[model samples]
Target: MDLQLTNKTAFITGSTSGIGFAIAKALLTEGAVVIINGRSQKNIDSAVKQLQAFVPNGKVSGIAVDFKDPSAMDAVKQKIDQLDILINNVGIYASKSFDKTTTNEWHEMFEVNLMSSVKLSKYFLPKMKANNWGRIIFISSECAQLVPEDLIAYSATKAAIQALSRGLAQTTKGSNVSVNTLAPGSTLTESAQEYIKNQAIIEHRSEEDVADDFFKKVRTSSLLQRFTQPKEIADMAVFLASPLSSATNGAVIKVDGGSIPGIV
Candidate 1:
């Protein structure tokens, strides 16, 4: 399983923590030259240091660019003319009732989750086409289909991602380049773990009990009956980034532990 990714360069957004960082680590393990991104210089530096410790001899770099700011991405564009792989992983979400969600919140969700990918692909996809080879992975979510009532805005953004991914994949028709989306379900990142712990305290129940109740009452359709680990999702992304996944263009691959419940 060489992955055939040695020396290939990759750029991932929001790589300072969580799923982004996990993907960066996996890519590095496969010998890819990885450039991580974050919103602040301090965070970027910290992530770079952490990654350097793990991939001592591997090439790792970082850039501070907030995708929400138009000007910030210009700086990012200047640093790299072309990329072998681009992972549009940066996103923001707010969980509130539709009546409580404001217009600004909707705009912010679309801006960061949807528009950022559109802009990045516009700039880099042509270069990929010219070279006749590249990989573009959009980190979508199971929410696109699940569409939780409290997460309408977030679900809308995720649905837009799937549509955009398919449209972009069409452009790569005869080329070696490929564009696809990876939709992951409830992954227990540090933040999620903290939230669950807080729920346990508030509900006067054990953490395991809280989790079990969640699967039974909230996510009853889930066959796995538990949260997925970040590394599990990262492994799928690593494979998608590699040359080994040549035929998977224009597809939505799910690492959602059977929570999505639909066969296609």
Candidate 2:
């Protein structure tokens, strides 16, 4: 299980928390130099401390760049020239009906979710190609296939991610560099934790009851019948980012709880 990641350097966007944080920790654990990203210096500092403590003697650092502000990425470009793994994990979501979702919300969704990946890949992929070895991973979502009613915009961006990742992979042809996507189902990130807590209070039930109701009603197709832990999704990402996963280019691998139903 030596992922062969020693000395490899990885940059994971929005890594101050949730699945991104888990991925950073996983790579650090495997002896990778991990660069974490977040919005503010304070948050980035805190995450770095937590990660350092959690991953024994881990080489980790952070840069503050709010991906929501597209211009902020310019700062990121100046910090690093080459990367062994570039994971586009930064994203935002707004749950609203088509009529209720404002135009700006739609734009923001696309900008943050899809454009961030687009921008990062544009800068890093070519460098990776020149180096003749790298990994570009987009963290998409199962909603791309499920297309939940309230999450239309979010799902649209995720669907675009699949297409983008495939197209990018096509450019890698015979190179050791690879581009791929990993679609996670319902995961227990901070937002999800808040949702469960709020629902429990609103329904006068336990948090467990709220989670059970979510699986039974909202995400009825979930075979796992529970939220997947952030670490579980991170594990798949870690594997995909490693030199061991060279053969999985252009693939849209799902870590869903069987929520996305399709034979392929």
The candidate maximizing TM-score is: 2
Q: Where does candidate 2 clash, by residue pair?
A: none
Model 2: per-residue Cα lDDT over 71-136, one tens digit each: 976898889888999999988998889899999999998998999889999999999999999999
Residues 1-264 of candidate 1 have per-residue lDDT tens digits of 889999999999988998999999999989999999989989989988898899898799988888888666688788988799999998889989999999999998898999989999999999999999999999999899999999999999999999999999998999999999999988888788998999999999999998888889988878889999989989999999999999899999999888898685
TM-scores for all predictions: 0.97, 0.99
- Compare the candidates by lDDT and give the number of the best one: 2
Model 2 scores a C-alpha lDDT of 0.94
lDDT of each: 0.92, 0.94
Off by over 4 Å in 2: none
Stretches > 4 Å off in candidate 1: none
